[model samples]
Target: MVPGIYRPRAVDRTLDRYRRSFSAIAIEGAKGVGKTATARQRAATVFKLDEPEALAIVQADHRRVLDARPPVLVDEWQRHPPIWDAIRNADDDGAAPGTFLLTGSADPRDAPAHTGAGRIARVRLRPLSLAERLDAPPTVSLAGLLAGDRPALDGDSDVDLERYVDEILLGGFPGLRRYEGQTHRAQLGSYLDLVVEKDFPQLGQRVRNPDALRRWMTAYAAATATTASFEKIRRATTSNDGDEPARTTVIPYRDALRRLYVLDPVPAWRPAAGSLGELGDAEKHHLVDPALAARLVRATKGRLLDGASSGPAIPRDGTQLGALFESLVTLSVRAYVSAAEAAEPEVRHLRTHRGEHEVDLIVEREDGDVLLIEVKLTAVPDDRDVAHLNWLAGRLGDQVIDRVIVTTGRAAYRRPDGVAVVPAALLGP
Candidate 1:
């Protein structure tokens, strides 16, 4: 129950389940999400390739790094890309299950020596979910809902809008969570600064204009939880001097940020069921952690409470708090879904071409069945709130295994119409 002590992550279950059956597993996520700590838990021998001495040894010969005992942890394996092929070759030479555990903050700029298809399975470690942050035992299960069992939803959380805002500003990054007020904001600023400065160059994309990159990132942060087009985002980043970076410059900027795992945009869902027609192709923008977005825009608790909008004056539905709340819900739901499904189901957003309707998050199973979710910042949702979910249910019928409205409400329960209402805190893996 220590504040910063290792709270078990939802992804731990997935790691445990797969580690015993796979020779190698790669854990990927944005920096500061605790990838190293999580991988260290399961590793017998760890080579932190980020450290100069450790990286030097590996650079001299990857075999020295790979010759360790079973369950050897290669922290930041992407630092020395050859370790991937070495691990793959070891797997080919009959490496035992769980022999190598690799943690990567970013994908290698160049492809690894081996593709690591069947040899190494990949798992993502996202920011801490609400359940993990609260250290609360989950009362409602995503797996149960996905099973089409109509499981009873019942639980209550003391977390309210104010506390949710605090979480959003404080962020779910383990290291940054301990600070508060200006200190918390400062740490988040530093984290983003690192991403813009060090993380990008390390990934082989030297940011020539750090200020311009920061402006673009701030603009993207402003677009969180909305399906804003890249053109609008580009416009938002236009400088006071009446200049905007060209498409060629913007492309590498976006690519570098994504490679660093900073921009975690939710792709628009394309249902195999063609009945859902003319879906929008725009992706919903989300920073890896909402706190980063809040910090980039200098959003404070008072500013959020007073309903002050942050960041570029981009058009978006609802207030900044609401979009952040939705981002929080999306983050937690994705974490839980990843833990529950083990394979990390396709988590995406839904929107029509002409701005007709939108679903907050769509979780699709491999079989093409989908779980529909709508996020509401309000404590209680009325019929009007779930209208889109109801519309989707009517359109997709039985294909929607279940519909849910994730809210900031206190209780988790189901409506008579079968749509489950879950408080963000009460719902988990």
Candidate 2:
């Protein structure tokens, strides 16, 4: 078992759900995102397939080895695809409740001839949120805010804007948490190398030129936090070659990144009564970690936070920071919703036909209740920031249950129209 550390409350919630349902749980995420550590911390007994001896033992007598340790935690189960069938068989015989907890950095689709449907309850684990990094002052809960509880804000301190930017640039991989200065940059570069050379090939993807993929990834990093059309990405990447890869190829590459738990594309959402044509199908691209975006910018560690003040000099038309801020907000909402066991909400970008208004995120609940969220990086809240959210509430009327604007500002307040303006720093799991 892994040594004791700060147990992620979110994983605890997932484990509880698995126990209640007698379901096999699969934790998927990027390399170095703490999957093994989190699983080991919770597992009764762990069998690590990465170790050669364990691999030999599992291949020699798969079922017997698993049965010996019922309720086993299999780390990197994707390494031996046949073990999945063994797990399914064990589950069928009712060998034990919560008999298996599987962890893998790769997706099941990438696994060699494995059927994981009946045996696994999948969970996608991303990097730590800004609140989880112990970077800024902590945020309050959305559940508390929705329940009409107003927590006291202890006013902002001497915020280390530079350090915060550095953290954002380095990302939330647990492996890069403690390094400082040039060492951090070196480690990040090494990480990118590993993702391209080692991780992608292991997932059964045949990349003729990893260099081209890396270039495309860099381009994506530059365009992070914007509504990116796949066609635009294809055009950019295919310029050198007369024959361009199809949208299908681009999607799998993106999915490979997602399965690694690094890339997340926020899709557009339309009201049930609204026409899908009116709402664009384009997805706003976001890296799972904002720091990855920062690396694409090639910005020095401290420049990310100075984005607004730095004016139009920065890339992506001065919207890079705002996009990262929006990505952060999206991640926070995803984390909160997942932890609360709320029905999986569909996250969408809201835009109108007239192009007069736009809202960053509209989380539509299973019960037809909508939670509208807007993201801003400014230290002071402005009415202009939430105009679309208000417009959405007015348009949807009774269909809207909660209206929230997550901002980088220090205070939390409610608008006269009942929109909750909150500090992004205060949002936590």
Candidate 3:
């Protein structure tokens, strides 16, 4: 176990649930999101696949090696696909419970092409959200209001926007957190190199020019916090020759990044009552860590502080930071949902045909209730800020139980219309 750090409540909650109900739990996320650390801290015994000795032992007798350690924690289980079957067999025999905790960065596509049922309970591990880092108070009481509780709105608190932006630029990766000065840049540079050199190859892609891929990654970074079409990305990266790769190439690379636990795509959400044909079908792209996006922009702390351009500046309109803020809110909400052991909430973007209205996020509950959320970087709330949410509430009637505006502002209060305007800082775990 790593010393000198408080356990993340979200992770601890997940571990508890795994111990109670599931024989095996798969903790998945992008690289450096703390899966290995969390599993190691909670597991009674751990077998690290990256170790040569462990690899040899598994290669010799996979079943014996796994069964040898009851309540085993297998780090990077994807490295040994046979072990998945072994775990399944062990579980089927009802030999014991809490026998395995599997952690992997690779997706099912890279995992031997088959993952049988009842093998594991899966959880998508994301970076430490702002609320998790702050160890925020339980606000699901407020979240519960969306389910028809009509709870009182918790007052908001002040947050330093500049520092918050810095956190975002620095990202949530634990490794990057320790480095200072140019060392941080060097570390992130090495990270990019590994993604291009090592990770891409592992995903079974044959890139003749890794440098070109790196360039494309940089271009994507510049376009981060915005809704850019994949075709546009292709045009930006493709060579003059018609022989350039298709938009399909972008998907694999993006998926590989996602599997590695980096890139995150924010899907557009339309109101359930609205006609599907009216809403736009575009997904806004966001890096799993906004700091990754900042790195992609090639911006330094000095550059960001100076408000100077490093690469192309991401627009500050409704489409850019607004989308990023929504993604941040989603990440926070996901952490909360996972901690509660409640039904997983689905996040969707809202839009209409005539462009009459739009909402940043729509959290769809399992019971068909919807919570409409709007995100803003500004602290001061205005009529324009909750305009879309109010419109949706009016249209959907009681179906929209809660309307919230998450912002960087100083105070949290309820508006006359019963919508809550909350500051991001007060949004705790």
| Winner by lDDT | 1
Q: Alpha-carbon error at 40 in model 1, in Å?
A: 0.8
Residue-level lDDT of model 1, residues 1-429, one tens digit each, is: 355467789998888888778899999999889998898888889999889999999899877756877689999888888888888888899988988999999987786756788879889888988888885677888888888888888988888888898888877898777787778777888888888878888888878788889999999999999988888999999999988988788889999888888899999998876888898999999999898899888888898888889889889988988899999888998898878754567898899998788999999887888899999888889998999999988999888899999988899998988889998888888
Which ten contiguous residues of candidate 3 have the minimum total lDDT? 312-321
Residue 423 CA error for candidate 1 (Å)?
Answer: 0.5
The regions of model 3 sitting more than 4 angstroms off are 1-6, 108-114, 135-146, 238-248, 270-277, 300-326, 353-356
Q: Per-residue lDDT of 23-126 in model 2, one digit per residue for the tens?
A: 47787777777788777765777888889998888888886556655567888888887887787776787756677888887765646465657566777777
lDDT, each prediction: 0.87, 0.68, 0.69
Error (Å) of candidate 2 at residue 91 is 2.0
TM-score head-to-head 1 vs 2, winner: 1
lDDT of 3 by residue, 1-429 (tens): 134464464656766776777788888887777888778776877888878888778878876556565678988887777788787777787756567888987764646544655567787777777766653453434346445665676654545677666666666666567776578777877887887887777767667767557656766666664566666665666554544556666777767777776677668776555533577677766667766666766666565545455553444345444444555666666665565446666777776744567777787777777888888877778899899998878877777768888887766778897888777667654
Q: Using lDDT as the measure, name the better of candidate 2 and candidate 3.
A: 3
Better of 2 and 3 by TM-score: 3
Query: What ordering of candidates by TM-score runs from best to worst?
Result: 1, 3, 2
Candidate 2 local lDDT, residue 118:
56
The regions of model 1 sitting more than 4 angstroms off are 1-4
